[model samples]
Target: MKTKFFSLLVACLIVTSVFSQANLNDYKYVIVPTKYDFLKESNQYQLNALTQFLFNKYGFETLMEGDEYPEDLVRNRCLALRSNVTKDAGLFKTKLLITLKGCNDQVVFTSQLGESREKEYNKAYTEAIRNAFKSFEAVNYKYEPKAKDVMVATENTEVKNEVAKEIKKLKEEIQALKEEKKAEVIEVEETVVEVVKKAPVVKVQTKEVKNTKEKVDMKASTSVLYAQEIENGFQLVDSSPKVIYKIKKTSMKDVFLVISKNGTLSKKGSDWILEYYENDVLKQEVLNIKF
Candidate 1:
């Protein structure tokens, strides 16, 4: 019975040890700092780099403080464990231990103390750090993000709800502003229409007269002419705003003449022709006119 009880106790202890190691494996990543508080310089003695390399070798993704981190780790730094290396000095030997802590600064795992008898600072520190990693080699590390506590989860949900409420309020305010702008545009358009309705109308009369001396009948029509009032007389345009002719008043009442850079137009047997001086020579072009 004593032998059986001893065996049972040993088995239970083995199971507990295995459970603790498996729990530690749940962490997805480890963050190593470029410099430790006790170190004089960043990556001094290459200890930080060595620590990162060992963490990576042990199947835990590792990043230095200056290295770009994964999005999940960036969002929730609690997702990864922080690695710390400590040195223990003796008269004849150097001792080292590596520790992993959570965001709460609580130590999660610590390696057994490793000692080296080398006299040089670089070699002794390197040997001691390598010896310390032996404890890490025994456990299998696979990334499994730790679950948040109930309280933390509830707090996060509340924060998300508040953010959602704020976004909704902003959207509503934008919609209200858009509606107000639309109403203002409609009001301005209505005011312009009212002003146009109240504007004064100008009347132009057309007369058909016979010129027996010239053996021609001249008819004046406004349908083919689009005139814009200018300072002198008017500018004649077609369907578009491009000025086809510039009409200026003459000494004769109600009579106008065409002025253009290309030429001046005169009536010849009911057809108009443009005459201009070009290259010290007179040039003439027949003009097609409705009036």
Candidate 2:
């Protein structure tokens, strides 16, 4: 009789322990909130309660809310997330999401299966959540101070003075560091200017811009003068010294030569704009102007 009683007690303890270490994979989502703990706002029918309480009860770790599981309730399992979605211009709607199986690797479960008896499903799911929380707590996160508690040290005037002296020494050292930085900055600026002066100046030939009237209605009432360039074979030449243009109507028909103040023919040039429109009738000439 004694042996039988001992075996029975051991079996009960084992069952309790097994339930306490329940994982999310071994359960299904509750389709409805159980009316078991109504007065407690924290025990709402949402996933938060399911996750939080389970985390609290079972000490579950490595499970994040809204993650590692689908958060939306299934369509058949869906209760309106929004009490009145029309109110506040559609702002008060709770997003209907499904809670997926955790660590089970199967996220999709039939919503119809859960809807048949949501209360029972929720009861089992809640139990699993509670177990998960228990597992989380089994591995607690508590910190112990590495240093001795400050209160244990008796107050002393000499110790206070020593700390104050060290602080004053640190301030003096900081002030010295600042002075050194200021001197270094001045030295760097002088060195930069000296380097610039020592560098050789290489002058590059600048190119001129050519302005031509667009054939369509996008033509703006603006005139531009640019430099004319001449290239040796395929090499590019940019030598812009002046440019000028006017919006007034001219008598050149469809051909307008942009005459530069330096007398370069705008229409007959091997330049960027003139060369591109070799077969086109020149509508306007961009002249270059120099001060």
Q: Can you give the TM-score per candidate against the true fold?
A: 0.50, 0.22
**Which regions of candidate 1 deviate over 4 angstroms?**
1-16, 146-291
lDDT of 1 by residue, 6-79 (tens): 99999996776676577677677888999977779999989899989988888888988878887566767877
Every candidate's CA RMSD: 13.8, 22.1
RMSD from true fold, candidate 2: 22.1
**Model 2 shows how many backbone clashes?**
39
Best by TM-score, which number? 1
Q: What is the lDDT of residue 179 in candidate 2?
A: 97
Could you tell me which 10 consecutive residues in candidate 1 have the lowest summed lDDT? Answer: 200-209
Segments in model 2 whose C-alpha atoms lie over 4 Å from true places: 15-47, 53-58, 62-225, 228-291
lDDT of each: 0.71, 0.34
